[model samples]
Target: MPPSADPTVSVTLAEIARIAGVGRAAVSNWRRRHDSFPAPVGGTDTSPQFALSQVEEWLRRQGKLDEVGSRERLWPEFEALGDRDAMGRAIAVAGARLARLTDKEAGPDDSAGWLPGGTDLSDAQRSLVERAVGLAKKHGARDTFDFLLGRWLDTHVRQINVTPSPLAALMAEVAELSRGGEAGDVGTVLDPACGTGGLLLAAARQWAGTADVPASGAPLRLLGQDVDATQAALAAVRLLLAGRSPERESAWGVDVRAGNTLRADPHPDVRADVVLCNPPFNERDWGYEELATDARWTYGLPPRTEPELAWTQHALSRLAPGGTAVLLLPPGVASRRAGRRVRAGLLRSGVLRAVVALPPGSAPPHSVALHLWVLRAPAEGGTDAGAGVLLVDAADVQQEPSGGTQRAGRAAIDWPLLHRRVVSAVQELRTIQTTQTGQAPQTAQTTPAAPAGNADGDRPADHAVVPVIDLLDEEVDLTPARHVPKKATSANLGLRRSWNRFGTLLHELRDLTATLSALELSGEEPAGQGTVTVGDLLRAGALTMRAGQQPADGVVRTGDAPDDAVRVLTVADVLAGGRSSGWLTAPDASAGENAGGLTLTAPGEVVVVGAHRAFGAWVETDAPTVLGSQLYALRADPALLDPWFLAGCLRAPANARQAGTHASTSSRIDVRRLQVLRLPLDEQRRYGEAFRRLTAFERSLREAGTIGGKLVDGLTDGIAAGRLPGNRP
Candidate 1:
């Protein structure tokens, strides 16, 4: 039986968008044309709401009642709604209903359902939701539903609005993995702000159901808390859907409710094994005078202008003496005027571990470059990790386009390479801890019996057991590279084991180069000159290209996009990193969007950076790699130059250096440069081989040294720690 109609279920433009799978603008149009919508139930200063029952019926009529989370219809509706205010009451009512539904207060269970509630369906509205969820079950689309719904609600509630910091994400994952060696199982991790709970989710997936994770729950623990209720509820649903709960048991202990770690504290005394977060960048809203005497400010008075400092202090206070934390912060936190004293204090205290300068792409489509701030408690009550700051320049990952007047785009993170590099660096640092302290422990052939004295002197036994300290250090500079070395510790050419891999790569590349040389020496080059300048080849359409840089460590270059995609690029990389200036007209903070040659790139399209128009730039790709699209993106081309081949061309010293001189404009380059300088087909192919060879050689050398250091680090450091798992004398 249908339940009583909801007269108060006010349907506003926003609510209509929420229910119709379209934007609010679409809802407004529907309201204008359809007379069935109930009269306005209530009104905000700028918007109005209608009966919930009427809204429900309208959704059913539109066939969108069962697909609330689908993004297919939402964008158009958003465009239609324009800037009109969404009636806030509609949201309040829906959220209240959702909360009640989630809590099982709407009614008793009426139908056998995945959701615990036996809530009865009232008006086709409830029926549609059930139907949509039911269809997801049929198609195995629950995860998508949950991800999108959570994102939508969070967007409205304003709890988790920030995007993920890719580099920061990589750092957190690496730190967690490294600790798995120390704790056996990384137990109980937490992220306070949680926003969309990316960190918490990443930590959970680390040892559960992921590529390397085992089936059963990991011995590791997970927890998250947020200040936004909608965000918290959304996170709760996400955690539940991810199989964190077993047979109705909770999946993780994450609460995305109200929580400002700096102001109102939750879980006050509990310490976590790992804490990963990217607190608000620079904040002035943080209360400065409220808690003048708070103990968390062990470093110095946190300036309200730099709220990131306060968050840093808060995260530090929460870590157990031996636990570790990785945070994403703006460059200002590392070397700003107002926060310098506090930053220095934390550094000198040996609480900071490393600082990594992330490339500009670190901020999703935004060009404001940031860094990773890694911190860990001292191992033996002392500040020195006994090492110099390991600095890393990642800006090169994001380089200028191949060529054109368009702006240079930021770089994308190569996660796999990044993960390996960071982990090996940390491990080498661990080895340092042992060497600075002394020698390794020795064990006898037979198992050593307990000492004559009581263990830990409980009741005065013969000898007491000594507790072991972990080998880890902290840095004064908040940058991840500061404590870590410029070269990968694993890349240590000085090591023997690493040399084996290095030698193999060297031999392989040398062999390949030799083969190419032989082919060249034979002169079997194409017969008819296969004449195909880029223009003729453009018609063939079978290639994709891109541009990149290996920027020096420490420099942070960012440019404004029409929208955050804009970037500062050299006329080298094919696709520019900037956004569509026509679309994102709002001027950015530093006035960069207009100040620079911001351009654009759509995902998966090929972009070519050439010396001249005839050959200056051309390429293609399908992935949404960033760029200021104005340069050049070849959509259907594979026979001419592959992606790897294209990347190599831009890396060539002669090609890159010479392209600038051939550039048409003072700041931007024209396509004519490459068209005349280099011909098509064979020569281009040769360039590709040469480029990949050098890159492969460079990689081989770097990887070999890194691998060797990683192998012997534990062995050599173990000799000093006495606790290094195996041999005892």
Candidate 2:
């Protein structure tokens, strides 16, 4: 039976855009220009929600529901539950329903205890599950579940601490290369802190493509454990769906449990051939005191400040004899004083075979370049290869330019090139260890030679391999940049590029100054009517204000977002005079009834940031955006007030000081108290043009100053490094 109308189901503007196959701006325009559009049923003024039933009916009338399939229709209903745990339970129920299609004996409760009361589903939620099963019948279970899982992951990205696809693939590839054998050679793989089975899936894909199999044709074993029971259940269901696909010729032995691996390990007796992990970084309370006397600390007792070291040791302890484990850790663990002894012991024991430094933006906390440590369980009697460790510095490699209006300094990793470079370096080191094991070890006193260039000659060398002895100094520093030698040619080219950019910015600055000087102004003061307060204008229906409120922790995602996500404008963006640098997605925060809601600003709206040091007001000319905290969006009635003129009045120094609620510099401005001068529409336009021109001039000045600083820094560094011609410091 078709599900009846459920008024409780609600969706945000972003979700509406997805349903109608349109941009978020399109939905905002529909709300503004179409009188018949649905009014907000719930949510705050800043972010309003609409009933899903009404939105669907409206879309059907407009012929937009013709192409939206079952998957799209079911998502908003699942999200409307307004709780992540509830959403996860819905997914588990859906998975169980799909499983029944393959096995008549399997009941609705056959999710293997993935969710408590697994068979329990509300009528609305159960109806959504049936739609998911219908989607699976047509598109196959794997693809259907994958789409739902992908959306869920994207929504709760920060909380889950997902390992991005590129980095996961890179780690899997490195693990395969380290094995020095066929892809299917590894018998067992485990991820202790696995969140939604990203690494385990990567490992499965690595082995799935190969022709090799054991004599018995037994499937590879995949094991995982996570702290969150819901995530663990989702991970298990994800693996089951992937393994049960008809196209797959072989299956996998999947076992994912929920528990704190450091405190009470569920798989203490089992050792795996390969362990790939991106453990939680900077965790202070990871069973430090309880597990202090635990035997996993083979190298040394980990300090409280160095939780990554503890995870590193745990990964090592879980490896089978002659097995390999690859772990992603913060760069601080390589050289921090607290973990120095542990690092030295690993190097001396020869179990730490190599350390590869990945570029920033490869994973979470994108500001720091993370490192990958490759270790192998020792043979009996702890026989060391004594061939010195391989330190690969791939941090400075070329990167793909960041998409959207992200800041210029932020760039994404070129995954293919980086994977090839690091993998090839590791293979070369393995070859050396195999061929020269018995010979006396050679001491490497200085930085190793630069890597060889590619045969294509288009890409320069970016990684260097360093020896272990040189790394075991008084500080025992393992930072890749400290060991990798920079190419003189690259430095010179960078200096040349900076000089060219400096010249271009100077020309632009001159043009801006000329434009500002040419603007004519009256020499005498003109007569004006008394000013009107912003509150008065709002009460008179001449303007509408949406005050910015603090959003949920996961509302704003930094760095990159999905293609459908909208950019969020923050107070920092206003103060810096730049494009939006944050992202907004459809995720349910604690905003009840208005979960996943968003308010998008129009082109002519005024954006005001009232925080004392961050005070500023400007007319938004870019695409629609959600205002971040401390911001206010004012959309004026065009017939009454000009947006640019209103923005200028609010931004005046005296007006801001008068509106400030406190006598401190950091006090916030009460935007309602700000005054706007009363003027005729024609006269407002005249002043608006002047304000717009001055605003452009100030923005250009800031850009010019930034470029000038870059130019000076480049020149200074070039001279210091002796990269400039005929120059000495």
Q: Clash number for every model?
A: 115, 0
Global lDDT of each candidate: 0.48, 0.74
lDDT of 2 by residue, 1-729 (tens): 234347888777767877777766678778889888899999766568898889988888787776435567678877877788778767777875665555343355444455423446677667777678777877667677778878887777767788887788889888887767776578889999998888998887776533232223568888999888777777877876666643443368788888888899878987898999999999999988889899999999999999999988999899988788899999999889988999988887878887888887778887678999988888667656547776777876555322212432233456677777687677776666767847655432232344575333123334444566777888888776777665555555666765666676677768877877887777865665778999999999999998765555666766545545556767777666555557665332222113334456679999888787888888987645766678888999999998889999899999988999886757999999999989999989988887887887776566667667877876777677765565655
lDDT of 1 by residue, 1-729 (tens): 223223544544654565555655566567678787656767642356566566666666767576333432222222222221121111222232332233243332232222212223333334334433433433333343453454354334322345453454575665664343543456667777776567777766654444233345454555666655434444544544454322333344444444666778765876877788767655577778897789889989887687888888888777776677888778767766677678667656767655666666556435555777677765546554334333344533433222211232323444444544455445544544545444432111111232465331111101111111211222223443333332222223224434555467667767766755565444474455432234444544544333333222222233323334333333433222223222221222112211122233454344555434323332323233323333455443445455445554433344435445543553333322332223365666666566556655554555545555666774565455454446567
Give each model a TM-score.
0.50, 0.75
Residue 520 accuracy (lDDT) in model 1: 41
Poorest 10 consecutive residues by lDDT, candidate 1: 459-468
Q: Between which residue pairs do clashes occur in model 2?
A: none
